[model samples]
Target: MALILVVEDDRLVRRLVREVLRAAGHNVRTAVDGRRGLRLLASATFDLLLTDVLMPGCDGLEVIQQAHRLRPGMPIIAMSGGGQWLKPDKCLNLSNRLGADRTLIKPVSPQRLLDEIRDLLGA
Candidate 1:
């Protein structure tokens, strides 16, 4: 129903998200990290961006800022499964302030993700 870019460092998470969205009829593309995500984003157009907040090279926050600058009205959902040093909720909070249209903690249910996407897409 929409072109979505899923940006996450964890391979399993990225694959799961892509598969779920695809199964639901979305055209889903994915990147392994935020830098790759930005590269893909720069070269193409996406109706929504679903990204993880923590990554090695670049982070979701940077991606969000650049994505917003590149496509001002693009809807963004930032997700995080924070490590020992950080908290998922705190990361999500920061992402919200940085202009994420929505946020989710990791281990998000597929149905919930789809529901949020439907709401964001006004479907």
Candidate 2:
């Protein structure tokens, strides 16, 4: 199993992801916001990062940047439900531009999410 950090502000979403990954046999850690996510990235090692794009205190784009800096080879999957101002497609495209290896629009299916992670990890 791989160690994955899941950064999401929405409580339900975060819990859902954590449970899904755990059920799939991945060791999962979570952050409520991007700042904490970055801190975790700095302190520990992660095989993959799965993050939501819109968050308070630091968005997923900045998290992706810092995570890349901390571990250049780590694969990142950016997700977004979109806000009133920005659409999900735009958020995902921006995430891609900022170096996220993959982007997913919410509500992401558990199977699809697992597939993405497996593909990235080649597991």
Candidate 3:
């Protein structure tokens, strides 16, 4: 099982993801926003980061940039609900540019999420 960090501003989403990852046998850690996510990244080691694309504080792209700088090849999976104003494609493209290993739209199935994570991490 991989150690997964889940970063999301929405409380419900965060809880769901944490529960899913834990149930999948992953060691899970969570942060409510990008800033806290970055702090966690600095303090602990995780096999992957699963973060929402848009957040209240620092965005997922910025978090990806910072995390990449800290851990050059760390894997990241960025997700987005598109937030009314933003497009999913735009978020996916930006996440790709920022070095996310993969991107997923919100409301993704738990099995699919686990599959993507495994595929990216090659586990």
Q: lDDT: which candidate is best?
A: 2
Q: List runs of model 2 lying over 4 Å from the truth.
A: none
Query: Cα lDDT of model 1 overall?
Result: 0.94
Consecutive 10-residue window with the lowest summed lDDT within model 1:
81-90
TM-score for predicted model 2 compared with the true structure: 0.99
lDDT tens digits, residue span 1-123, model 1 = 899999999999999999999999999989998889999999898999999999988999999999998888999999999878999999999999999999999999999999999999999
Record all residue pairs in model 3 with backbone atoms less than 3 Å apart, i.e. clashing. none
User: Tens digit of lDDT per residue, candidate 2, span 1-123?
Assistant: 999999999999999999999999999999999999999999999999999999988999999989989999999999999999999999999999999999999999999999999999999
Ranking by lDDT: 2, 1, 3
> lDDT of model 2 at residue 102?
97
Clashes of 2: 0
Assess candidate 3 and give its lDDT: 0.91
| Per-prediction TM-score | 0.98, 0.99, 0.96
- Clash count, candidate 3: 0
Instruction: Give the lowest summed-lDDT range of ten residues in model 3.
Output: 80-89
Ranking by TM-score: 2, 1, 3
Best by TM-score: 2
RMSD of each: 0.6, 0.5, 0.8
